[model samples]
Target: MLLPVVALLAASCKKMFDVKPEQVVDQTQMYRNVNDADAAILGLYGKLMNLAKQHVVLNELRADLMDVTDNANDALKQVTLNNVASNNTYADPRAYYQVILNCNDVIKNFQIMVANKKFTRDEFNQRYGDVVALRSWVYLQAGIQYGTVPYVTSALETIDDVKDESKFPRLSLDKLIDTLIKVTDSIPYKDVYVTGSSLVTTIDGYNTGKFFINKKCLLGDLYLWRSAFTKSDIDARLAAGYYKQVMETGGNGDYDTYRIKWSEVTTNNDIAVGYWNDGRVNQYSENMLVDDNDYGWRSIFARGQDALYNTEWIWMLYFNASFSPENPFIDLFSNRGGSYLVKPSQAAIDGWDAQVQSDNNFPYDARKRLTYKTLDGQPVIMKYLYNYVDETTYLPTSLLNKPGKWFLYRAAQLHLHYAEAANRDGRHKIAYALVNNGLSYNFDNSPGAGTKRDVTNTQQTFDPETAYQFDARYGDNPTFRAPWHRNVGIRGRAHLKALPVNGADSTTLIENMIVDESGLELAYEGSRWADLLRIAIRRNEPAFVADKVYNKLVKDGNGSAAATRARLLAKDWFLPFKWE
Candidate 1:
């Protein structure tokens, strides 16, 4: 069910340039028309969408598990740690290049048009601006994911032209970032045409300014990239400056102010840049969360009665209602009983019980609430849940059918990022405050937030200890503990996870705290892998230690001390290049 927009565009380009066409237009003749330039720009956007699809899969694959334990699944294991080199066939370097190719074509073709004076001054600026911005975006994606990648600035029309690819050697990380910044500067933020209808004006105009790339999105992305790169290489002050810019540009604001009601995403905002199917309102949510009998099309990992909601997903890619069958999340959570596969892990169950106990103020700040459910006994945050399907029949109902919007960037994430950056810069107090602000948004305050209910002043109140004990009773049996039971504390009482007050300045402690926060605040949002890698590099943690604990039921599996130790020493923890 992957989209075929790229294939179609490539085919169209070949047809346009083919010698055998019924009527051929030479390159000289093509740039003479304004429509030709417009078509070229539109093709760039089409390519952007195609690239986005590939990213969605890559994001999920990075943290995806085989059976709930920390051990790599078939897909991840093949490309990540503890897997055979022969299993590396799934990594698709070409998918990224496809985007780069489109960008190269736009840049090259647009330059030709500009040189020929084929467009008016305004037209030339607008069209050229978009292509440049898009090119920068494509390169940024490649740089972030693959680190040093081949930089192809020119488009190739034939396979033979790409044979001497060595000529386009990998660019250093610093050089790539500089190049991206230069490209970004050429484009005007406010003037570019948006893809959808305008929100302010009622008229159905061409410039909607809602979903298209704009100044705010670009700035936010630049800030993120700069923050990442500077965290390791550049001056701390430079990173701080970038983060300050992000906060000032409306990147850090209230979710309710921008978020669409009932949906898990916002339409258009200063920080938000992209769109995705919000499973919360979409049929996928209803089918996956409510209708357990229809487990055939849910996500493969979190399916059936074992299906769980991911509260940390800040941005989820959109899936067409018609394409529900192809969405793995939909099939994984659908309730066809045990038809879907995957046993829960012991580590996960233990983690769940610990979270429930900590929610009621047991040992200390409970990190589980950030990543899992509360300990008391309330339903898990249903940010991705919907009630549109009949529970017994597992059929879709009109009441629950709607498309969910994808939020590219969110204020909460900005806060967390700011905290990390601040900590890196030795601003411990600022980082702690920012982290608290970010956590404030989703804190719970009810008795049954995580565990069992006890009689209170007048009504039944959830006793956190009771809830923890309940989960402990079923820790060995993954089948008994429902996903909702995992977060009973979320609905009960408000509590924030404790930040490292002692080691705020210590690089090791700061790195550990940041990693822990990311796990809590960004888990299952396709961020775990990157977070792990960044921390490992930043803290100099053992590369492949057996200390890692995945949330599956296997006794002494990958998360066991031995396996974690082994992983810490292994070089395969980082993803390998498809060929090397």
Candidate 2:
């Protein structure tokens, strides 16, 4: 799979941000400069953007939280029915392989750039590690959907080269996870690239730094998969450690930059709704004032890339309409000016409706209003409908003209995944607290606990591990309050009450809660099917996934629920890898 003519990079550097951006030119002349390398990386991301709709469909449609609408095409309907045809357009692996091919080209050529003294060792390490992580992420997505894929890392001229069975053996999901962990673990630079590096740029007024793949998040995810596949405490602990690295204070001197403070959420119309720090925003619909309180949580998705958003978003990609590949989500999720093909299932709405706030006994999660909304007589996903500017206002059908975002990694995911790992590692109390309430609320509340937020909880007590502890200390004294002291667990940030852990299998119960919380907090964005599949495989219970999908199908009035469940119980968790 050696490089050939390299037609993908013939365009000038200025055209690199186009939808069909180039990856490389002639190998002998390419990677001769850092600018060349930067263009290649940007091009790789452009290719990654093409997979946004496919990624969401592959990850969520097959799972429980999302359902295809009547307007959906045959391929999408096939996905929801768990009867994807071999020729189904959505089942095609070429889009994923297109990304992997670009990542491979970048990784291979960047090494040559470093060797030729065209790039510094540090520069090469950071970019090289990023491309590697991006590739790993793509492979993880591929493995999750297809089960067995040709894990090709070498650069090649055409995607067809991987068809050679002897040279590129198809690896199963478990083996792919192992290879990703080993390869990603070996990278020297595990953190984000140094801030303000040449690789960081501004495109359409948004900083491109968040566009890059996060290395630590990728490693944590890899280890999490491995931990599930092997049921090893060591792997779980390793996964927790990596997630902690992302959640801890960033090096930019911003205290609690990546943390969701316990005080951020509110049941009443006060301060902020969730992670959004922008002052009280007036939410509007159809040029009329609807509600002011609903804007905060929505800001997490609707706001532009800035210090306020960087706190929660670890990695994100934006699609400009002026660019070649417009935001695909506008067509998939928006009911205005676009085809609303897929939507949040009734199961997802019910999941959010079941939540009750701890402090005020709020009937439903505050996030429910922000996630999806009723428009044109039907509920549609709201997260991707508006651009940063008009999230609070319905200013025409902007979905056709405004830019849309694709969330790859964020703070909630870091905490949720860490809690999953910690629970598996025998830290169930900490994990349970992290999901329902913050560490301070569930653990640090005890005798002589200074803050009113802290409470004495003897029933769920556990010795605090230094790695997972978040100090409950409060008050005006900065001397006493540690950085993570402001940290709030995932459900806590949604103002939800803590779930009691009374069962003998506390770990399993808490783990299941974590999985459920993932569905509630992260629905429609992706990761639903993968989360269910991983847990089902780990527990060696096919019904774990089958039951959820079956429930969702039945709730959505799909007659194929029973048949799909039967297929799932037969160990059919992945799409058919027809390329093989």
Candidate 3:
């Protein structure tokens, strides 16, 4: 792509009219000095942190997983019910566009920094890589929520540039992702090692190691999302390619991994007397630290918690409470009467309770307690928070607590993505292993196979014949023969298995399982609504979306469910690009 000469950059006096190409600030001025270079890049991250709350609203709240409280204002309720009006607060685009502007600024200016000898070539690639990743993050949100949005790459600088919002045309999610793949491709990466995998040794340290994304993470993520929108095996295989790269980056097949205590895996055997048979009110011992314990969650991953040095986050935005508006998690999920807008839906609560009740041996899912904080009258989500307290003091839990960090990507998310991609490509054996390998539960198999038989029938194990390493790209591995509902069929605490889904009857079966897993694991962290949209579009299954997202799930008043089902019938997965 060539840029026009200065002579042809604008309209001519006695010629056909043409608009001058808008230039934001002089990229040269922003990136020339080391100080400005640092500030500009840091600013990009700061801008991203600010958009975190809105990101949740657009990504998680719009999905069927939540319901609006009666206390919600009309604007919030409208979005909660998908009664999106042109002027609805949830329909605002600027919240994301502002982040795009910061990304463009960092991108266009970084080159000047390199030219001015402010950063070495290697370092230049690293900083520019961060900017590109941030851009991809925003692009992903907008692509999913808006379907197509003004794809602005360059910053809007001058007065004319600011005024001329129409200069950039809205592009499809496919086109945006194409750009994302290319952006991650350009970053300089190195092979490095961090913990969590002891297998395949070499990994690209594209933007440092595990915390900031390397090329493999970007490629894996980009292609996985891409697979949702395309019917081609090309995208599926491409996703596998990147996911394989991530796996191999670990070397020696995922050694040195972190996992929860085995005793906590399946049902607590002694708890035949637990709440429900069941434990009483959140009584897990303080010493019972799980991988997702808030202690480490805040210590290692919270914003300003020595973030740059901590690993495994892949990409995250750390927030500072000193800003004009502190971290927004409180206002977003506030339990203060009349203040909070969103709460967990009856569907989520009912589904979770049902999942636990169906298996009487199990007391509860640890994730359930961690995710939703059920108040006396109304329940609300708590995944984004535990208590807003200064980490060291834990005492003064402030209602306006501000230390919130967005966990955008992590090893667990990748693992789930790998399993789904493999399953979709018809590689059930490997999919089963990938899911089971790091499965968080340990089975209490002492109950005898009769009581332990998840299906309780002697129909034979789904894949009783063979064993092989998990590799989904090629189907040469051993087979997984678990029944459709799995129903704790696998020989473990959390009986997650490679579902019997290699044939035509199981396509929806497999898809539904993956969607269910994603919702359970990544609840309220963003990506839920995108999952709904992707599945609806990919399978051309509007009824599924309507049934799950609108009707079967929520308790509707105001005919919101019926109205939303009608829109899904129209194949509408997004609010109109323009409010109109």
Candidate 4:
């Protein structure tokens, strides 16, 4: 039987906040100091971590890149088939609202913490901004998963308060996005926690920085969604502006830090290998029996969380094996010592295989090897092989004992998002360069005055606007070594051949490349559906998303492919909210 929303809310509150009457205390006790404030914020992240599997599954299974295996239960199959039932365990909206409710509690009480002189202005700003951004993020995800959700800002006191439909009416996705954009734009502390802040410290042997949502990145995402919804150049530029701020702010105002460098490659006979300069070897090969250090592009996932990974990942939630809730992905994707519930779709596998690497010796993307591989004749997701002793062996006797990661944002995604915004804003070539090659490569190759297009200009036409320019000019002049100069295009870094840019439809073509590259670079990372949805909404073309999902289902020999496409074309794009 389906549970009512009130039952869900009540269960969440009872689990999260229930206490005996003697132990129940006032807000003043909880907000006594910064330590208490920090505890509250950390508690929110703990709750968020509980929802990680739902976030990844809803965003992925409902889209095209991932598919359920024969072992997958009814809930998984239903979501993949685009026929999600109200009682599907994965379809629960309560977890999302539970996080939102706590955020409301924090938001409401933090003010009292400040008014009582328990927190300094700086402390209040930093902590309050985080909770606000996080709450908006959860709400945005909820709105995306469900077509409409009750947008409640303040924490409701009783189950009746939550059950009152008139007081907390559901808001449509469009209105929800507008509300989020407005709320996020006003966040006072848009930057990360300043150095030495308690929130920046390590917890349980992991740096806490990756746990907090980035305000600017969230703003960029909000504006990007708004731009898609409105199809407005102004909103697109606003999104680009916020994204640029994130890229520039990453290395303490030095953009060069995050830009992938051409020098960061393994050289063979004076030729660049397009792999990370890290010394780790790529042990996962067709001939290799055991997967060793799958470095290069895969290091972003394989390597232990360290300084290097932080450079790329803006936000990631880590689940410790010792923690309360175990890693859900262990059973969902792992084929070793776990229920292999899902595997990479054939369409996604073929998409990567179709690409030829920049080295020209390989016809497939090396990343595909790291993304997923055949183990014992079964396609297994290799990315989440966190506790595996080798390619074919898993170390943990109990799969639930293994720790897993939930990826949220990263540098490559940042670049692609900015490119999306800039492209819609009419900076087509700039957008293409970001996907295929770095800004400097295009800037350096721009046609000289009166030079023939074939001779001096092998590159696509460059936009001359200062805003579109990345200023990659570099040499003996130390001043020229700016951040944009170090940018090797996203595909360039991946060692893939640059998809040529031309024709009157260049903007659309580049946008499509961005989406495709996102699939190749970020598949199974909880973004495929949102990326498709955004583009489909922007162009008002249901076929854009429908065809992708259709192809996936078709390859699986599902009879529902045509029906799913028809439903999507009719704009029946959201999961049903039938809680009865």
Candidate 5:
């Protein structure tokens, strides 16, 4: 008897928040034609849209600016609360499993198609390879976020379809790493041709782009996952081996390749696999950007014309308006007369200044520009804000359109991975070099340009030779200098310094540096919480604590003060797990 495909694939909803699949395709029909199989694959991509949306919430809430402790006393005040449970609720494991089911369907149907002589060997292999890679990608997200997830290689249709959910406990870190490695090995390294109407086609012709998995990016992701899961198990040999693979595959031996891959505006050789959201046509952008005046929560309040942008955001799901009208980041950063939805925190600004300055010994080195702003004929560096805007007019078609793709995996992060691995494996020199090299990419030694006051120009002038002198004069006191003048002057002091050649626990120091760099480099890439968890686990940090005191501050009659105070309570910060 033929098993019903719906029985095999329909997911059992456990929570009210679970999104019911709007449409379901029968497995029998799924493999009968190329379009059927292609549609199944498209479903996998559709599931990825959830990842893009989740990323925005995760990045904004976890960044230094948002207070994780706050919960609105009433529905009105809760709008901006950074409650972990609320965020975690949005990242439901079942939602991820739904995506996995789509991938499983693709893999299963592709196998069936090949067996039935419906697909050639080349077609089967290529399609099978894509499915395997996509499945691995989904598992990586699940494994990293919710450790020891149920590994389902087949689609689940009915309640009985879920084979031994209780029996499938969390896999060990070593096992998880092995699984990812094997998955990566299965994908073909060579390029594959894709011909189809562009999802964002402005005209009628199909817009085709060559697609293939870069061994380096895949391996880099593997290493990152490995590092995340098995920090203690990481040794020098393994670290060097993986890093060498990344460097060799990267072609550009320089570390810049890893860093630049994070740019949404540029898509070249570095990316392994990721989605692009052009505002003009992407559905996700439409949901986020289009004025929802007729229905839902957005319809009640002033419809947010701009989405969300945080200078702290390192890697984002980008939306290109030329491709789609719903690009969210465009509205978020473009100052089209909208209320600035996101603002850099004072702490983040201070951190940016610190990152740009030179160390006392290394006077010539430049620092990373974490954020940027224009003020008083000088550019004030804001650590989180990367894009520049000229006007703040609220119009759908404003010139403030800044379109850049979101980076899933960046080169700078890989360097940090190398540094961490080196530190873990007792390669202090290598770790230091990797960290410094990554920081060097953002340094600028050129004199100030644009409407510069004489004093501003003098202070903004970045001379490698005099970097030490500048650090000494302005390093301790950042406030003394004008905001614009201070931007370049502090580069020497702010940039991460190289590790000491000898220390009691050089490895630990390297580890700390890696953690610090992770915080500095990936401040707003939906990584802070993960980083915090990793550090807590590695360092055995006692239950999280809140450093800020809310009572000392005054609040307007609005519940902002109480909300802020409640947010400051460390105990209430973490997500309350249903099981916990």
Candidate 6:
């Protein structure tokens, strides 16, 4: 319906993450009707796609989870080693700002369309609700990754909009939060899902609820970032309140709104058999070992193609090959055949292995196997892989007609976000269940008839292929369940380094555990850098940050340990935007 333009040809970060004058559309014409407004909304998501993979490198690779293999290009290596420069090409200011400009276009024009009676009141709020949340989500990403950035809200309709330095100066952290809070407060569908199974026409084709931001999800994360950056208990409480609203809405007591579809493991007729061989259903095949899907972990990525409406993804970015062109992620991360510039760090592989609780004849944390694969003595990161799944399974990737589905906000992150903020705010009971108990919990401490466990009943068994812990059939109990008491869920399934109900840890240690759980769940998904940076910047704890991220990279010989440490200690933590 509409064609999205590239970054404005003007200076990057020089003028409000400027876009050239040609990039701006006629606000009057674009807001003519609901259909016209829908086209403009599509443009916003197109720009978001441009930022999706860039965010991964900006956040994930800069942290410890990734490293440049010998085959990686110089620019990628520089970012990996923290040897980035001011004019380096990948350090593009337009990456974040481009998304902002698209958002600004929609935010600026919504009221015009609404006043014209082009859309009913509810439809206008529905549209306005999305525009508001999308803008905040962009700013949240900006605040976490880039220290201070030029903030703009009104449409950049002229060269004057592009060149006016006095109009939009880089905002301080506090100012960014103020602007964000004001915007988030205005959305009508805060914790609520607005799309009701109807498809809207956009540049990306017809789509549903998965692509739109859930207002409370954005607000909760925004507050969490503010709390982490400012170290304010007040901010932390605000974040928890929003997250509590999210829990109350769709996924109450169960991550049903955002969980993996593990039922397909056994339910599918062509499902890989013998995934959990425990001598029960001998579905093993020709290979000595079971296939990756048969093992349970690979299914997450395969299933991610349809995860949009699921509980695991609060919101995600979808790409349509026919409507647009190519999904950058598929080109960048896919292994079927592409220029593979990066891979998982050896440290990440080792760290994941070390974190596993028990062998049980396979890997402990399903994420490790699910996240990466070893090739040529190196770990090829496979978190976004779908080609293999398309070839063998009935996953929705085939149905999506596109391969690039980037998860922006997710439930596990929220679980830990709530836990991190709650722990910081001295809400131990709330933080404890978010991780240890999981959404699968039944209200009672006792096992749910079959799969539950305890210290004395540590050897109890649930479905080995099951990703979720609680069962609705047993009556969805919104509390801790069997394996949780015996050190499951956040604990390694087999490794079981339990967060004791009566553990003798101080507040500091419990908070650390909560943050670490975020790592375990959200790893390799473009969040690690901010997770480390937020605490380091707030507490002035470079030493601790170095231990969590830098130490792992250096010890694994990713680059010179001295250079890594020196770069970290000198000046600031995040890369600076080089203004002309």
**Best candidate (score: TM-score):** 2
lDDT of 1 at 253: 31
| TM-score per candidate, chains pooled | 0.58, 0.89, 0.72, 0.87, 0.57, 0.78
On lDDT, the stronger of 2 and 6 is: 2
Q: Which regions of candidate 2 fall more than 4 Å away from where they truly are? A: 1-16, 19-29, 251-255, 264-295, 388-400, 445-466, 475-479, 503-505
Model 6 lDDT per residue over 1-580, tens place: 1224423222221221122345565534456666556556555665676777778887887887777656667788777777778776667666666667767767666787678787777777777787777878788777765667677877665423533568878776667877898878777755444454122212223344566777877777777777766788788888877775664454434433433222233433111112334455465322322235423334444453343235455666655544343566655654445456777776676665655333233434445655666644556667676543342442335434445567677656766777777777766544664566433332344544454332232222233312112232222233333222322234422122445656543556767777766666677788888787777766677765666557667656764656776767663566666534
What residue runs in model 1 are displaced by over 4 Å at the alpha carbon? 1-73, 76-89, 116-147, 158-163, 172-240, 250-317, 321-407, 438-508, 542-570, 573-580
Where model 4 places Cα greater than 4 Å from the true spot, the runs are 1-28, 158-160, 250-256, 267-294, 387-400, 446-469, 476-479, 503-505
Candidate 5 residue lDDT tens string, 1-580: 1212122222221111112344444445456655454445444543554565345444434334332222212221232343434334544555566566767766776777888988677667666676676667667665645556666776556423443657455564447657877776656632233344221111112121211233444454566555544564443335445554543332333322232222122321112111234545443222222122222211111111122111111222333333222334433333333323343334444444454223223222122222323433333322222322321222344455543344454444555666565566555544554564322222223322322222322333243322111210111122323222221111121233433446454776666666655654555444554555444444444232122213212211224544544664433433332221
Positional deviation of residue 88's Cα in model 4 after best superposition, in angstroms: 1.4
For model 4, how does the per-residue alpha-carbon lDDT over 1-580 read when each residue is reduced to its tens digit? Answer: 0111111112112232112234334554566788777767766776787788888898888898899998989999988877888899888877887788888888887898899888998899899999999999999888888878888988766423554678889889889999999888887788988668776765556666677898888988888998888988888888888887777765534544455545343331111123432345453233431223433566576566665566677888776655545678787887777799999999999998998876444788767876787877899887777444353454445544676677888888888999999999988867877888676566555422222223222232344543354655544322345556557788877777888765654778888989999999889989888899889988999999999999999998888999999988888888876454
Put the candidates in TM-score order, highest first.
Answer: 2, 4, 6, 3, 1, 5
lDDT of 1 by residue, 1-580 (tens): 1112222113123221112223324455454546666545544454454444335334433332213223234654433233325335445556566656766665676677767777666676766666666667667666656656667777776323333557777775557877777666656543435333112121111122333344434544454455455564333434444444433432223222211112123431111111233545542221222212222112211222121112222222332343221223322222221112222233433433443221233432233322223212322221122232343343334433432223344334544555565566665544554444222122223322333432122111122322111111112123322222222111111133344366335645654555555544444444445555444544545441224332221342543434433554553453344442
Q: How many backbone clashes does every candidate have?
A: 68, 0, 27, 3, 53, 18
Report the CA-based lDDT of candidate 1 relative to the real structure: 0.40
Model 5 backbone overlap count: 53
* Candidate 6 Cα errors over 4 Å, as ranges: 1-29, 158-164, 191-207, 251-255, 259-275, 278-297, 304-309, 334-336, 358-364, 388-402, 437-488, 491-502
Cα lDDT tens digits for candidate 2, 1-580: 3333132333333443574315335566667777767767777787788888889998899999899888999999989878898889888898888888878977877887898899899888888988898889999999999999998988888888877879999999999999999899999888776667776666567777778888888888899999888999999988988887787747324455677655433332222244332345343122221234234556678766656677788888887776757778877887776788998888888998898866557677767777787877888888777572344454444535757788888888888899899899998777876777665555553523465442323313344654564444443333345454565677766767777677654778888899999998888888888899889989999999999989999999998899999999999877877664
Span of ten consecutive residues with least summed lDDT in model 2: 284-293
A best-first ranking of the candidates according to their lDDT comes to 2, 4, 6, 3, 5, 1
lDDT of 6 at 546: 67
lDDT of 1 at 287: 21
Cα error of candidate 2 at position 354, Å: 1.2
Instruction: For each candidate in turn, give its C-alpha RMSD to the true structure in angstroms.
Output: 13.8, 4.4, 10.8, 5.9, 14.3, 7.8
Candidate with maximal lDDT = 2
